[model samples]
Target: MKWKKLLAATLALGISAVVMAGCGSDKAASNGEKALVIGDTTFNSSNEEPDVNPHNAYAGWACIRYGIGETLIKYSDKMELQPWLATKWENVDEFTWKFTLRDDVTFSSGRKMDAAAVKQCLEHLIANNKRAAQDLKIAAIEANGQELIIKTTEPRPALLNYLGDPYGCIIDVDAGFEQGIVAGTGPYIATDIKTDDHLVLKKNEHYWGGTPKLDKITIRTITDGNTLSSALQSGEVQAAYGMAYESYPLFKNDKYNISQISTSRCFFGKMNFDPDSVCADPAVRQAIAMGIDKENFVAKLLDGNGFPANGVFPAGPAFGGDKVKAEKFDLDGAKKVLEAAGWVDTDGDGIREKNGKKLVIKWLTYPSRQELPLLAESAQATLKEIGMQVEINNTADNNQVVKDTKAWDVYAMANVQAPTGDPEYWFTVFATSNATKNQGKYRSARLDALENQLSREFDPAKRAQLALDMQQVVLDDHAFVFCSFLKMSMISKANVKNYTSHACDYYQVTADLDVE
Candidate 1:
């Protein structure tokens, strides 16, 4: 929480400076009006390439989505898998798949994209991309003419979905690793990068998708919400991504085109399950879950920008089934549950104590999403009414905070659980004993079995059933206190056309985008 005071002061100064600079600038209009400017707060990389490295998980999404890289497969607006760099693919056998590469595709460095290129990219991905390496479990990949034969260790029904992940972005193998800006086959190429400040991309006339409508694009990083809003309002930036929910009303006019797309991401709290942790008790976790007012948090705190989450996956039957619902907010019920579990307010103090220990919880959350810290504060007030003392640590570095298991009991975080449009992805990342992203170290045998079944089961109905069963298992254990599903919003000038939002939060600016 030490960084919060500094962050607030820094943000105030940054906002003031940006607002003054924006009010006096006419850069967007003066630059031939052909350049598209985007303002965003989610750029995590300071590298010159920004997110060109497929191995860097935090920067990979930005690289793939912003046309700096291309994946073999991509998801459609409807969340269906579609061909991108690879023209088409088919299952050769239970464990082997073959893909047909696009002959016309060429990297920015003029390297031809053939079956060999595809194989090299996949090989690099397997070595660097942790998620792809874990999910694919590929035994071998062979390039034969224009066909790529991929043999997995097991029958992976979601192979296409896994390849569609941003981490699976294909790059020019020769220049990708050694250069700052890797050569890609996408419509736009990174011409220049200024780390956290800005990125300049120029059109790739040789792009197989056809030349983009815009000649150039600039992505500027403005972390402060007020600065982003001001930049957009003053026409300093033509578009903005990840704007604060409270700033939506500022763009509710004809001049701006606001696109609100519901994503697979969910904001939730993870309870530490370490044996020595205070939240190790199942009743304590359940009590906290029962005390949270998810509906109110979404409606009031989020300004109805999101839906109350009931499980790891979102609402669709393809990923999240309809079996589970949001947990009811019951303060009295939570207090009774704690009392039955031997946590009682024996002394005059409001907080309950078990044995000689006070019922105090250390809560940790980040401020990047702009909603998590507020959610932490709200939960703190709500839990206190149930004789639980919650101490919140609002830090910018949650990854480091989670490492100290003894210092924190609950951690609020957000993730697109089913980014690949498959439930198995969520299970592998959160439910399994060896899950890399499972900071809480939650493990369940039943959930593991269900996840295994879900992975191989290709039948739609059967997969849905397995997904529902897995949700129930996690809900029963109270592994996560489900909060809300994110509805990401992007605001742009009215002239900016074809700027669509994807369910997975994958694609952003594409070849079809243009400014009137």
Candidate 2:
């Protein structure tokens, strides 16, 4: 189950390659016009189109829809919010807010955009609790002709952050959200879509702002690392999607340039914390954490593509970066803890036991990530030395992992976390109230208090102190074993002059990239 080896073995170039070039045409009509083709790792969401309403989990859909849609606010790389569809916003009171909508915006379907349309769109996403609904605290929204007013249950200073989410981008309501082809106000319009294949988008010439440089852009889906690498080499696709850290070294050819981007995404292992689960014991969780040397795991197992994670948040925020002194590996210490916890086999059966119970647990993972299963294998070998019975179970689909919350003993996979850097999100994930709640029903009070303190205290000095204190609690509790912070890499042709990437591996096709 070594993913690095398996991926490298299954590597092969994909489908008949197709290339198109016309750099010399229409130079005078548009200032910096160029068409670029890109490849993504998985098929984009079909139903989660962002242009209609909102779907937070939409992958390429979020970004692409952002280009074709509009938002009241947009986020800069600095994490600052800037005006987009809204001209100005006013905080009428601690819980009341108002936004003056821009009068010039229009949807792709030739419908004029207004406050009512925007309000409706936000309401749709808020109604569907599974998507962008939970992230916000909106109590009510009403459109006063050209002005939009919002009321929240609490004074949310981070309200701007929610609006800046790519999912919060606005869409047209004239086109039924559930039945629309594509209705948005962004710079581009999706002209055609081939499920699990490619999305063809053409620049909206009648856009409020001047038309984009590129007349057309096509995003093709290529899940195989080798296929994407070949696509970039053959010029079938000018850019490859997110490349694995291990796969980056192989693409060191002079023909293509590599770019590193920053994102809030990090890969970590969440141990089952329910009392009914075998991983509930702090000793067992600590043993599992200490068993695998994360530093070596990153270097040898991950081919040096990531850094060992000391906390849930990747190094930088107030709450992350510094590793807890106690969480450091002490293999002898782990053996002692397990022994003291009665996890020793008295029956000489090769497995540890306590009160006639065998120490056995299942480690669950998915196939999308070519790393977790391999890590599981290595973990099994490491834990076996402690006389623990460990089994790696490759779970099918994310739903199966969710279902296991009610039936299985353990689960391990990539969990996409919000980037706000607030510990409350973690508390919500692990608190009892959140169990069977979005975070898999894992509950811990220590984790909750740490998160609560991090949320309201926005000052840098205070926030940093809280983050450090909370990180210590997280390490002690072992609700999750912080693993590694991934480094996002991408391969594009040398001539792909303006192609770029974000740390989270998302791309902004219009502003950040272009081609000569």
Candidate 3:
């Protein structure tokens, strides 16, 4: 009743579009104050973006997303790498790369950005961040005035792409990370940071780039979609990210602009391979793959925002999409697969049983990504029809809970499978045998060997083929189920300028972002 009433009250914008100037009212307040607040769904600690310290966990995402940090390289709309802090770079040898630094950049803490600063930042990152240390085998680094050279422990063909990761945001290590805030060379400087609450930021007056327009910016973590929508409607926030698809209809007026783009962000499930777990059975994994209605889930549940994904990487890059194959939705085929695995509905209670146990999938997921919970519920209903019982454990403590292999049979989560516009990011973090966050404990010897070849191969064509081969290995094993890619949208008031969405989804707030 509350949701329906809220929807009813918010839907009046359709009628207001005729009477008023547009769906939202014209600016009646003074333009002197340029304080802007944005409602974000995944801004909390639960999403691993707890603070603006780039070296701490995944907090670098928050640092980059909110314009508190800048990387040496950034991705363009075409997903190609462009130099940011670095003027130019070149591969010196099989294990060495050198970069020319910009001469005029300074950190928010008033320190000059030189090759020494860059060297200090990366050394601290490789020492603290496990994923960074593994991905970037930086055996040694040499610093000269504006010339910084890096020598990897091995031949890393994709080193530049890995450096563009959110964790690659360069900061002034000497300034220190006090109160989770580092001296960054970005447009904004974080003032206060509270986990699972809100972040306060102010424009960097001495920013090396263009002058920041807004005086103050607040990023409020609104976990609930309804509350985020209501806040935007009530003028509490000038913009909102992660608004529910159902509420998108309320904001599709002349007054609100929805900046949307297709992203490689995917909602996929990793099957646990515990020895005694049912997901250990290859047939059970195959049946579970074919059981979910991915097409309908995207059409109805997702409101046709995105397309059903066939593999880990979407169909944009040479190694993405149809290059690999996954299971299709076929109820009859799924039933046969389950029966062949000795799981049957012996008691005729609709759900299948094996020996004395029921065919129940402990579906573990988190609620921070709105699409994830929706996918879990959607899968629960669809899997039920295919003689499987899904017990969902959707909580914010998912990072801790997923650590226990026995607690979850299938863990559904949202990740940018190709955040760096490279297929290697996905395999190194999840699919590889020694993956940093391989919560499912899935190991494929062939996949590991292929990833080894991919890491050292410098040729783009050969890398693409190796990636294609690696994806097929995991898909054939039914280790991960790729559901649908995300079509992200950022709904903001019409007055907001340059608050556009990026294909990379790494950048949001910038010096150009202003409310006029």
Candidate 4:
């Protein structure tokens, strides 16, 4: 996890390599005009294609981020919930809620976004989208004139927050699912999709928010961070997202504008708690936690771009409470813990062993974000110094690799912990026993209880206390090595106006975005 500094050294050369590789070209015009091109590193056509289904978490968010979709509620630039589609909502009971839809809203396909449409979309998502199905726990969605009544399986005080998630976007079900085309209520309509390459979107003339300034938008997929930066520099792209921290220097000139927003995203290593897993032992997990220097990792590796994490959540009121602080880095303490746990370097091969079994750990990661593999490599080097054998696997298919490989002990990944501005979402997705994203299989009764309390508590003060309690429990158990809070950066041409970054890391491009 400490590779940010080392990676910075090669940024110049990386950008040069991309420029030399012929990544730059003349700005492609659309309909006899310059189309605003956005280059992003996180665009994956395999999961995003076929209408950018809101059922898939990442793709759903991408659709919302790129202004191809809209949710019932949305977070403003100040991280406050604001009305988008549904003007207002009221809680009828502990499990029942009602939302009032905007009568003027219409899908790009000319379908009115009525209560019936919202109900159909919610029902489809609850039945098909695994994350939505689990998070919402909706028992029924009924259309009542211009309002929609939702009944959940349990008390959901943060139901509006959950509904504001990207997956809750209302789409023209007939057009999106049946025809495999994105017909949304946003300001843009997806016109063409070329898998793994680019997606073309046209301004929605029927948009309730009025016509967008740009007539056309081309979202180009450039997975490499350096190439994304080079594209912006070469005038091929008007804006670039997921830019490497090192590449910011390239846009320091007044001609370019850089927006860095600190988000709830945390880069961390998840330790598997399965009985046979090497990281199953608390001592081993603690040793691994202590082995990595998170302070230095954030300060030096990330070039002071990120905040060092102490607990599971990042620094914020909605998620990070007053109870969290950075864990002390103690390399000597780590060695002592391993030794006390009966692991020692018996063969003098620099790797600890117990009962003739070498203490080797398989670290799994992906390269979609250029920093992950580098972080894994850095963790490998640090763990090796602590007399642990670390094998790194930087694969494209992390899900398949994790499913097939039984040797994986640690998985380095990054996630927006509070995507919904609630701690319940993060805890339910990554900490609960039955969580789909909890690939590590970490389970704790106390943590689960705290999560349940957080979900049901309506009082802001009580909810914040419950969230902090959960963070303390996870920190005490050493569930994972919390690294740093990500600072999402967007580099764009100076003329790109109304392009602001949000803390949730969800909304990027909006109808307001325009070139001056």
Query: Whose lDDT is greatest here?
Result: 3
Per-residue error for 196 in candidate 2, Å, reads: 4.0
lDDT of each: 0.78, 0.62, 0.86, 0.77
Candidate 1 least-lDDT 10 residues: 1-10
What's the C-alpha lDDT at position 265 in model 2?
Answer: 55
Show the lowest summed lDDT stretch of 10 residues, model 2: 10-19
lDDT of 3 at 73: 88
Clashes found in each candidate (C-alpha, N, C closer than 3 A)? 0, 8, 0, 1
Better of 1 and 2 by TM-score: 1
Whole-model lDDT for model 1 versus the true structure?
Answer: 0.78
Alpha carbon RMSD to native, model 3: 7.8
> Between which residue pairs do clashes occur in model 3?
none
Predicted candidate 4 versus true structure: per-residue lDDT over 1-516, tens digit per residue: 112332344344333333322333333342253357788777774233334668765578767887888999998655678888999988999999988989999887777889998888888888887878888989988997789999999998888888888888888776654223467888887665545666666678778998787766677778787778777888878888877777777898999888888887888888888788888888889899888877777776677878878787766566663357545777788899999999999889999998888999889987667677767876787888889888988876676666643758998887888888777887787788878778888889998887877778899889988888888887778887788888887888988877778888777777787876
Candidate 1: Cα lDDT at 332: 93
Ranking by TM-score: 3, 4, 1, 2
Evaluated at residue 155, the lDDT of candidate 2 is 64
Q: Each model's RMSD to truth, in Å?
A: 6.5, 7.9, 7.8, 7.7
Name model 1 segments beyond 4 Å from true. Answer: 1-33, 45-50, 178-180
After the best TM-score superposition of candidate 2, give how far the Cα of residue 275 lies from its true spot, in angstroms: 4.1
Which tens-of-lDDT digit does each residue in 1-516 have in candidate 1?
222332333344333333333432323334353577788876644211245566665566777768878888888767888888888898988799999988888887677888888788888878876767999889999998788999999888888888888778787777644324567778887755555676667677788888888776777888677888888988888888878888899899999898878887788888899987778988899899999888888998899999988777776657664467546789999998999999999996899989888999899887667788789988999999999899999876666778888878998887887888777888787777777678888889898888778778778789878888888888888888888898978898888887777788867878988887
